[model samples]
Target: MTGIRAALARRWPTIVIFMLLGPVLFMLFDMAFEQMSQDPGLTLARLGNWIAEDVFFVPRFVFMLGALPAAVVGALVAWRDSRGLASGRWIGGLSAGFGIVIGIFFARNLFIFTPPPLGAQLAIGARAFVSVVLAGFLCYGLSRPFARPLLSQEER
Candidate 1:
């Protein structure tokens, strides 16, 4: 508990900044993806509706259940990155965290309101887990270049 607390205390500013910005980024990405994909089927209202219907909806909810684990992973990455000028681990971790953040936000919308058969809940859970893991791995793979420079001692 203390270790996490300390990490939070040290990293809180960065974490909170990213956390708060997450929704804005989400909206931007959502809109951008919609536009780029030219998905006429999606609208802001429909998007909101999907968000409402999916995941475990809580009123006035900001944080999704997956955010907790995601943030932990992100912090770990960021901490590792902080060790040098650029840490791939940090980007990888943060990217994973961001993926989870985005994933949970969407997943919450998907499963939140639907009447569940136990199987459906299990399915959603499995999908959500896969999405989070994939996001992390993708981020890690993509971050190697960016993180490499930072991780190098020359930068320090």
Candidate 2:
């Protein structure tokens, strides 16, 4: 639709930033997961082996290789979007909304596998609700500074 395209046109930089950094963020998270996947003793053994094999380079490799491009691209997007208040607000709010939506999807996945302890489930659901609300509020707050100033400038 024209509306969707127009909106994207206005916030393309933010979208691209999200796209570019998303993978790096994902890989960062993946590294954490990878570490978790290894048992402590096993991890030590592997570390020893890496050193013995001269591959102590493994973990550092991922960090060094993956982090820069992602960070740079993300920074570029953030800088571009930071140009003006109006577009910045729009971009920030939408990004927050998207994050909350994604959080909901993750919550749904968790709900199905969640233990059925009645009170616990209630607590989890409440926590999820609170998290979503907080995420939305965070987005709104971040946008407010940009939006308010932009609107005031327009009025003048």
Candidate 3:
């Protein structure tokens, strides 16, 4: 318990920033999913319903969209804290990739109701997991070239 508390105390700023950014991330996910879907109108309507009808849904959605990705970014930031700006850019890209993956899973589950087909569920999970990981790697690869360190040489 003490260990967990200590970690939280050390990392509270990052956690809080992520939590605050949750809504923005959720909106980005919503927009991305909206664009991807065949019917944008229907997507907007469903999103509206979720926001208006269920208070709990938004928080969960935000958590999945925001907190999960933020956690990944935060972990990377902590891991690569002393690293340079290149690392920062990679972190951003990685974070975005993760956010998108988590968003896709949450969005699919939100809209699609799969029947009790164990195999189907397994397949979907596997596919989604693989795709998300691939996307993350892609993001990392693309962003690494552009990344700049977060701190200056003097700081290091």
Candidate 4:
């Protein structure tokens, strides 16, 4: 208990930041995917309606249960990336979100409706995990060239 309190006392700011950041990150991921799914090209104007629609939907409400944790993981990725490199957080968050989506997809395929062969689940899990790793690296690489130039001199 003392240890917990001490940790919290030292880390409360981080805790609070994450509590605020998590929902915003989740909403951004949700909006980006929803927008892309709705149209392959730009649809910025439609976002207002989509956000309003999203909040009222029951399925989305249920999915938020899963997404919040995933978004927090994304937030962690973003936070880590921010520490090391500028502009990495955007793509890092996207990659991490994609990783979470891959995980959810695998779970649904392997266990949600019907159990698959043990070998199949193992194979899929290995592939999905590798994909997640590669995606992060790829996104990080993509962001590297863009990071420095995008920042102001003060930020750099």
Q: What TM-score quantifies how close candidate 4 is to the native fold?
A: 0.40
Model 2 scores a TM of 0.33
Error of 3 at 142 (Å): 21
Clashes of 4: 0
Clashing pairs in 4: none
How does each model score on TM-score? Answer: 0.39, 0.33, 0.41, 0.40
> C-alpha displacement of 150 in model 3, angstroms?
13
lDDT of 3 by residue, 2-106 (tens): 654544444444444444554444454444444454455446567666556765565565546555655555445433432332354565566456655664565
Q: How does model 4 fare in lDDT?
A: 0.48
Q: In candidate 4, how many Å is residue 51 off?
A: 0.4
Ranking, TM-score, top scorer first: 3, 4, 1, 2
Tens digits of per-residue lDDT for model 1, 98-155: 5555555454555535746766545444444444445455434443443333234456
lDDT of 2 by residue, 45-149 (tens): 654554456434444553365345434433444444445323444445544554454445433544435455766445444443444334333433333332232
Relative to the true structure, how large is the alpha-carbon lDDT of every model?
0.48, 0.43, 0.48, 0.48
Report the lDDT of model 3 for residue 36. 51
User: Where does model 3 exceed 4 Å of error?
Assistant: 1-12, 28-50, 55-69, 103-108, 111-156
Counting clashing residue pairs in each candidate, in order, gives 15, 0, 6, 0
| Candidate 1 global CA lDDT score | 0.48
